[model samples]
Target: MPATVTKTWKLFIGGAFPRTESGRTIKAVAGGTVHHLCKASRKDLRDAVESARAAQVKWAASTAYLRGQVLHRLAEMMQARHGEFVDAIRATARITPRKARDEVDAAIEHVVCFAGWTDKIAIVLGSQNPVAGPFYTFSGIEPTGVVAVLAPDASPLLGALALACPALAAGNAVVLVASERHPIPALVLAEAFATSDLPGGVCNVLTGDHGELAPAMAGHRDIDAIVAAASGKRATALKEGVAENMKRVQVVDPDSDFTDARWRSPAVFRGVTECKTVWMPAMA
Candidate 1:
């Protein structure tokens, strides 16, 4: 009889797959097969933050058109590997095939929608101020640097995409903590990110216990912002932990439908960006 090959999955960090420093693994059952997924530790979170911090400047400096093109390429990659996402969602979420397909489709569409916003967001949010002074003042939005996202457990892929796409579109490097309950879809999504034209460390995925990882993400000084799709105590903890850094924190409504057009609003794009006004001498 031929030998069966079993694949071991690791955390996605710095554009590479590395085992968790803690060396802990969680058992996940998918399609009647058992798999071991890395349980990311505090050290892993720190490493991810370093990578994101290093990559954020270059990513933010890229032209808006280039950013849009990269994001669009991500959408195309997701569309090409649509079946893999569907399968992962079905396996981890225990949802029917039809529902799984719907989730996967929604995720891809969300990416595409956010991709379009990469080039238009500044126009929508920025403005030229009418001042009496001879100088021309204009306020423009810029990325908030490293952003941490807590993915919703109910809809792993969809929720993660909902929170991450806007951040990425705004030129922020992201460290996404996947759903503790259903992380397989996140791992599959990480693969899509790796193959996409996204710069390394722009999007890092970690799978493990949210309770343990959320604090690390919230308290990290390098993380300039946080978008959490978690509610109740989890959201409270995140908000409270970030008090030291006073980092921008947004706790989204857990019950909200991620597939709605509302998620694609300019508000989402603006939330992860900081506005700066530049004053220049006007021609007399």
Candidate 2:
């Protein structure tokens, strides 16, 4: 038997692994094998978005409890594949086995944490109040619809899944741009999602050229929000670029601890609808 892995998996899109429409491949070392590039194009992005949109209405309307269950199922799937996730991370990101497993575990934990938030949002963030008038008014949260995420290169699995968990938990469909450094985890996560009973486009992952596709995302009217984990000039550029769609941006501290207590709160989450009300009356 061979000691080194000779083959790796393909990009998951529309519930399948497809060759690039461009019929092109980039040569890269994945799992100790010469891996072929799985090129994704603008059309693929649209297709993925369409699937996500189709799933949106039902997913958005789904009770927070059901959404949470779906996420917990996803976490279970991920936990079952924990070793494989670690192996893929170790191979692609070039991290120690312990480090790889930690990140993978952190991702799972993030999903489960967010899952708990689904039903608890009302208790934590919503409120019932006297309208100060004859009628009564109440406040609640809502999903922001489709959100596109640009996964950070440093901690591929963590950042991608971190943003994904909240993005989806809040009932928003998500599209993640896989990190250039480690695309394998995104694929594996995509596979886990495939088994999670999520809507087809509810969580889409693509591995491709960021520069080329980012502009399209920045200006996309369909996308309600966008998040990117980056440094230096790239961060600045993305902030300005997303202006066309007015997508919300959430910048994270790169050096922060993964298991920080602050992450448990809903205020820390981004990419959701927050309704503010104002009441004014003039008395004679």
Candidate lDDT (C-alpha), each? 0.89, 0.74
TM, every model: 0.96, 0.87
Model 1, backbone clash pairs (residues 3+ apart or across chains), number: 0
Model 1 TM-score on a 0 to 1 scale: 0.96
Name the 10 consecutive residues with the lowest summed lDDT in model 1.
Answer: 253-262
Query: Cα-based RMSD of the predictions, in order?
Result: 1.4, 3.6
lDDT of 1 by residue, 1-284 (tens): 99999778889998998999999999999878999999999999999989888988999999988998898898899998899888888876768999999999999888888888988988999999998989999999999989998898877899999999999999999999888899888998888999999998999999999888877777888889999887778888889866869888899986678988789899887569999999988986
User: How far off is model 2, as Cα RMSD?
Assistant: 3.6
Model 1, residue 252: what's the lDDT? 90
